[model samples]
Target: MIVITAPTGNIGRHLLPLLLESAPAHDEEVRVVVRDPARLPGAVRARVEVITGSHGDAGVVDRAFEGADAVFWLVPPDASLNPKDAYCGFTRPAAKALAAHGVGHVVGVSALGRGTPLADRAGLVTASLAMDDLIADTGVAYRALANPSFFENLLEDADSIREKGVFTDAADADRRAPLVAVADIAAVAAGLLLERSWTGRDSVPVLGPQDLSPNDLARIMTEQLGHPVRYERQAPDELYTTLVGYGLNEAFARGVVDMKRAKDEGLDTGVARTADTASRITFEQWCAQTLKPAVLS
Candidate 1:
């Protein structure tokens, strides 16, 4: 059995069909733990066994993990909640359930910057790494898909990009950082879950093809969307205030500030992508195919 959590989320939505298509060939049973069964597409609901509840619930995960060989884990973000409680608190129950249920393997969505000097101060990244540690301690074969800032994050401000022809962030305008597409992240997770031979704990850095700064992205956006687009670097204080205004609590807002600061300081630049780690989608392709359409829509 292969258990998947957050099956309706950005990555999970893409992951579900890939796993289902391969299930018949591999003879794998797929199970999903979701808060809202209704949110699952009708096609998916008919294909996999569904456990209706949040994965953070011990009962939900324990029931879902029955006879499970591999599990895809992703702790969805809640900006209104405390960072530690949101990440590590939610993970503890699932980790305990994994040990109790004897699930063999787990693929968790986590961030980059595990061993770096800046990791300790990288706010949400720090909390996520700590969550990874708790899961690793459970003795399940674990692989944390350590990703950089997602290209999908741009869609959150698609309205601004379309209306004002501008996007904003706290990072330095010229500091290039890896940005990955969630589709590629899902693909890697599906591949790992399909082949359950791997063992022990490790971090898989799913860096996209190359680094691109926000300025570089704006230039690309201009060409791709056939309109003027610009990158605006907000002051750290301004960014924090803006996030708080968006309903994020102060702690979570501070975490976002710290993460952006770490990126500007080159925290994500340290890891060079290996052949197996590098995702094929480039920022330009993602802009043309994903971001451009999102802006138009």
Candidate 2:
């Protein structure tokens, strides 16, 4: 059996269909740990065994990982907690469960900048890397998909772009860095789970086809969406204050601010985009396919 966590989420929602489509041929049964079974489509729930609860819960992972060959792990963001508690604390229980269950191979969704100087200070990214360490310590054959900021993140700015022809971020206007589509991340995760041929622990960098800066993104959005788009660089302090004002934990707000600062300082530029590392989705393509619709709608 193969287990998947957060099956109704962005990455999991895409990963499930790919696994479900191929698992039958491989003689693999798919199981999912989810809080709300109803969030899964009727057809999806029928195809997999559902363990209902937060995967962060020891009891839920204990049940889900039992008799499972490989597992896809994803931690849903909880802004109520600090960075370490949000990522590492959430995975601690599951890490123990993996060892106890003796699951062979595991694929986890994680961030980039593991070996870079900025990694230790990148706040949330630092916490994510630490979580990867915790999982690897369990001695399961683990592959942490180290990914950069996703194109899907732009969806959060769609309304602002549509209304004012502008979007905001903490990065400098001309500082280029890799970005990826969540679909590509999901596809990579599915492939690893199905193959299960690799051993030991290592991170796979899912850098997209090319690097892009805020200005590049604005230019692409203008051409694809048929509107004049502009980039707005927000101060890190302002971003932090806004997040905290929205009732997020103070430490969590600082984590976001620190992450933004690191990315601006080239935290994500450590990885070179080669064929093996670069994923298929380009930002321009994603803008046309995903962003345009979201903005126009």
Candidate 3:
């Protein structure tokens, strides 16, 4: 049996069908922990066992993990809360349940920056890595999907790009870094959850096809959307204030700034992509397929 958390989320929504498609062949049972079972599609609700509650709740996770062999774990972002409390706090209960239930494999969505020189200073990344440590300490077989900035993040700026032909960020406009498509992330997670041969704890870096700077991204967006889009680099302080304006707590806002600064300082450049780690989607392909439609809508 495999238990999945955040079944209605971006990755989890895509992951559910993939897992279900493969489950019958493998003779696996699939279950999910959701805050609202109503948010799940009728097909999904009909197929998997649904436990209605946040997975962060100890009781919810404990009940969901019963008779489960593997699990897909992801802490859905809550910017208004403290980063540490949101990430590590959310994982602790699941960790306990994993050990208690003897669930052998756990695939978690985590960020990339583990061995970088400034990892300790990278706020959000640091918290995510710490969460991985907490889960690994349970001695369950763990694979933390160490992803870089997501290509899907670009969609958040789609409206701004459509209206003003500009997007802003704290990172330097010329700094190139890895970016992965969330679909590819889901694909990797689904594959890992389906197979039980691997053991022990490890990090799987799901880097995109190649590195691209914000300027490169803007150029691609311009071509894809048939408009001249520009990249604006905001000062770290300005970015922090803007994030606070969006209702994030001061500490979490600062973490967002720190994460961008770390990326500007080459935090994501430390890892080279291997055939197994490199995802198939390119920035251009994602822009054409995902971002362009979002902008038009």
Report the number of the highest-lDDT candidate.
Answer: 2
Residues 58-134 of candidate 2 have per-residue lDDT tens digits of 99899999999999999997999999999999999999999999999999999999988999999899999999999
Off by more than 4 A, model 2: none
Residues 1-297, model 3: lDDT tens digits: 999999889898889999999999999989999998999999889999999999999999999998999999999867877889879988889889989999889999998889889899998988999999999999989999999999888778888998999998888888888998988999999999998789999999999999999999999989989989999889999888888998899999888888889988988888888898899998989988989889999
After the best TM-score superposition of candidate 2, give how far the Cα of residue 89 lies from its true spot, in angstroms: 0.8
Error of 2 at 269 (Å): 0.7
Q: Considering every candidate listed, which one attains the maximal TM-score?
A: 2
Error of 1 at 56 (Å): 1.2
Q: Relative to the true structure, how large is the alpha-carbon lDDT of every model? A: 0.91, 0.94, 0.90
Each candidate: how many clashes? Answer: 0, 0, 0
Instruction: Show where candidate 3 strays beyond 4 Å.
Output: none
Backbone clash tally for model 3?
0
Better of 1 and 2 by TM-score: 2
TM-score of each: 0.98, 0.99, 0.98
TM-score of 3: 0.98
